[model samples]
Target: MKATTVQNTFDDITLWNKMREGDEKSFSILFKRYYDDLVSYGNSLSPDKEKVQDCVQDVFIDVWNYKEKVQSAVVVKAYLLSSVRKRIARLYQRDHIFRKSTSIDAVSFHMEFSVEHELIDDDYATKQKVLHLNNLLNNLPARQKEALYLRYHQGLAVEQIAEMLDINYQSASNLVYRALITLRKEWKGALSLITLLSSGSF
Candidate 1:
């Protein structure tokens, strides 16, 4: 899992509570859990990796400084993600005028997946199929791809995705629905092709 959502699931309630109670260890754990994800998400908005890193660090700093005042979060991970986005945008506004402005709402999302080890066997054909599917997934529109990733990978519900993306509930549902429709349309044929290739029917 490259730059994956580090939490096994969004059940960060315990971690959040600990962090709020002045537990540095728990805070570190939470920061590690979301650090890579925040960097990746920040990269989606701007090419400046350094700026993204600064913003991510700043967000955690703020977390520490104001932890006592923090309220309980049903989805702590979503809150962190939103903070990263908003922080990056604000930094962009304060620092410089980018040709492509860094607006969280206008983030151009992209996802990258790791090919499984089975697909990395000595079989060259299987590798190609995996690569093809990888390409297809990478090509999905930012929002649609984000919807699918949150739904399938992070195990987040549509409501959580809506809040993270700052979109309406129906919009999030439709976005995910459309992505599934697109993937389902190609899924069978892609699987069949992989099967046929695996069987050496090429």
Candidate 2:
């Protein structure tokens, strides 16, 4: 397998195991590989270019800072995606309400799956799933949708979602739970479609 192949499946047990052993090269490779993709993921959640960029940058820094303590990644892509999501959520809570003017809010995101690997043989299936998931997400209730986006897409915690939304932990949990349940219901006919598209399996 190629070097980039390690980044594809969360099940690629060897690469993560190497990174756990204080492997600088391993981590650097991972960071460089995912950087652009994470930025795009962040952009999809909010229209703020600076915040999205900052969010993706912070994710790499945080991962490096915690590398020693990090355990087996629960889907490395999911973990990275969630980290960027939470960072953006924090930026939102800190500035959204009080800011009179900001460039972050003016940014627009086109939810198109950017194909990083031109060589990756099957991309259409993946892109289709991403688009399908984006549409499903757009159908959720605003609060619930934001919470879910911040939590999973941005990889925020319950407390962070609460802080971002100005709600309590329980309320945030409820929103996330409700949102997942709604998606589960809404995605009834599209199970295969979703599994094919996301870094996350449906």
Candidate 3:
């Protein structure tokens, strides 16, 4: 079988194990699978597109170099997300953009939500609603916004989010929970907005 064919047949953990044994095909597959996601997540954490892209590349390079020492990941997506986040944070500190005392929490996270007009019959109303919903999301504290993005946008569980954010489980859960509550309280179309989130339309 072709290397690509064989690589496609295996799951992330299996491919990770293969890469550990010096399988370049497996490493390439993993990098392709998560590159866009890692870039998007990294961009949310840092506004510098060039820096984000560089950090993402650095992450994959590190993974490939240390494949032999890296353990099999139970959740590869979460692992990569955490890795890129830490990479961005370190780069910011090294550039003196962030204080020595700064951590991931000190890094600003920005998320924007878009609603498709086709999802709703009334284009004008949809635009108005989307604007309001976006305002509410932008007003949320940075941590809350990040939590919501990880939970809803990335489909990460609270536990995975906790590990990525380096926060306690309850804190992660509360961040998501409170974010939803605030949105629900402020928006009359909370259900529709939530539907858009759950459906991954935003």
Q: What are the models' TM-scores?
A: 0.75, 0.50, 0.86
Q: Stretches of candidate 1 above 4 Å error?
A: 1-11, 95-102, 113-129, 189-202
lDDT of 2: 0.62
lDDT of 2 by residue, 156-198 (tens): 6787666555568999899988767756654433244224233
lDDT of each: 0.71, 0.62, 0.82
Worst 10 residues of 2 by lDDT: 193-202
**After best superposition, candidate 2 residue 145: deviation in angstroms?**
7.1
Q: Can you write out model 1's per-residue Cα lDDT over 60-172, one digit (the tens) per residue?
A: 99989999998876688777877887887677666657566656576666545444535355667766655675666667788887777667655578998898788899999
Clashes in predicted model 1? 0
List candidate 2 segments past 4 Å from native: 1-13, 97-202
Clashes of each: 0, 5, 0
Candidate 3, residue 50: CA error in Å? Answer: 1.5
- In the range 23-75, model 3's lDDT, one tens digit per residue, is 99888999988999999989888889998999999999999999888887668
Q: Ten-residue segment with the worst summed lDDT in candidate 3?
A: 114-123
